[model samples]
Target: MKYVLFVYGDEKPWADAGAAEREAVYAQWGAYESLLTEHGARRGGNELAASATATTIRKQDGQVLITDGPFAETVEQISGYMVVEAADQAQAVEFAKAQPGEVFLRAVHDYGLDHLAPAEAPPGVRYTLLVYGPGGQETTPEQAAASAQEHYAYIELLLARGAFLDTVALQGLDTAALVRKPGVEVLITHGPFAETVEHLGGYYEIVAKDLDEAIELAKALPEPVVEVRPVVEYSG
Candidate 1:
């Protein structure tokens, strides 16, 4: 099976730390990655940028609205995440506890991303796989292309199997913000925080049989961390 480890922490320390101190902290993460590699449990992971530069977008009443900032404001911000292949929830929890901050572990559910489209989803709760990590801007163009190719192929396979619903690769923080009350003459702008760390770089909507099946799909992807959350069916 596979699991997504959402690593959260206060960004003040790292953001305020000296260059050397920050480097040391990064080194710690390197060590952790090495450990995962040694155990053959490291599927993928990443260190996101600060959350100061984010763009949020939304559409309503046939109009699209754009703004700046994350989807929510919180004290314990997401610092990073890791995608790991484990035996079960217990094993996944063990890996999370070893991380350097508070972590959240949620089982992936089997639901397709079709609900996001105009067509109705089949009779069942679907799942949305949120891919969080460093954006392509963090790397050289060549590297980003190569990494994207790997991910694209993985996605293609899922699509072929009728499991993929949608896939979107987002722009970097420089172009991030929030769009509130779209489709109106006037728009409100709530930009991203001044200090940005992590952004939702991309995402995938897929259908799986259950948590285990979802993990299997995640384990095959090349993303650093893939978050699987249940999509609630609204009757209203």
Candidate 2:
């Protein structure tokens, strides 16, 4: 099974930290990455730019409304995510427990779209579209099927435009687990993280010419809200 570890934390502290502090944090992350790589569990992942750099898009009254900022205001925002292939939920949980800050782990729902490769750099800049919607809502079989078809069609459009890099659909929150490190020990809690009106459902990573083009492409997502952020690039 594949799991996504969503790393969340308040950006303020990092922004206020001195150069030495920032380097220390980066070193910690490097060590974490090494651990995952050594275990052969790392599949793919990326660090996202700050939430303030996010561009949100939603369809309101048949018009696509674009705005600057995240979909919802929250104390801690998502900083990055790591995708890992694990034997089962238990193993995935163990991986999360090793991570820093608050980590939300969700199993990935395979849609057989894993064969798609991300576009090359010359094609455009990469952006991740964070899909959010009302969680724990029950839907009939017919409704579920309709939603799947809509998503398939939308994905086809992205593929034709060469904008589709990778996409992931997560299982419901009931199956999610949250890992938090407050002190020397890591606390693990089964999720339904909070009683929020919106919850992150999944995400789409795509390459676009620029922000405007990315927003135009994101408008086709069949979701209530899509928060688009540029993927950070690091030189080795």
Candidate 3:
């Protein structure tokens, strides 16, 4: 089956890591990637920028409302993700747990959701994963940035798999676009989503063995912390 591995966790620590430390940490992932490739397990994936650079887009009343920061507020936001072709949810969870990083495992999921109106989800196959961090667990803010190095490989493994789907990443929250709307009174504000915990960092859409298999695959998803849900099919 295919699974969207929602990879969430602290970024600054890894991103801030020294050259040597960064290289070593990511190097550990090489073995995991090879394991997947050797077994023909991964599909595809991608690395995300910090939430700071992300632009949230919401379709409202025939209009695409673009906003700033993350889609919601949270501390452990999605940093990156991968797509894997696991035999079942168990395998998916295994793959997720194996994701390379330093933060104590945070969260994992299979990934899903019903597409918004006017936006028809692709037909072929795809998985959706929202990455987030565990509250009170992620280390200091600086360390969060340090761990971003593993993102490159985390994404590449899925690309290696055959079920790779669409991927979107954030690059650090942008405060300039903050705005509040009241009828015609749209007030722009400066801030980010949840400053504590529970925010999207990035996501992966993929095809898995089957829904049941997908659930197993999600069980193995990696962390900061996250949840998984199936895409609600709406054929209107």
TM-score comparison, 1 vs 2, better candidate: 2
lDDT per residue for candidate 1 within 138-226, as digits (tens), equals 58789878987897688777766667766555444543322222234323232232243444656666676764565567656665555
User: What local lDDT score does residue 174 receive in model 3, on the 0 to 100 scale?
Assistant: 37
Local distance difference test, each candidate? 0.57, 0.88, 0.49
Q: Per-candidate TM vs. native?
A: 0.48, 0.94, 0.45
Query: Candidate 1: misplaced stretches above 4 Å?
Result: 109-236
The deviation in Å at residue 3 for candidate 3 is 0.9
Each model's Cα RMSD: 18.8, 1.6, 18.6
lDDT of 3 by residue, 10-124 (tens): 6678668999997787687677778789879876554555666444444346544444555555556556556667776556555655666311111223223222111333344
lDDT of 3: 0.49
Residue 121, candidate 2: alpha-carbon lDDT: 40
- The TM-score that candidate 1 achieves is 0.48
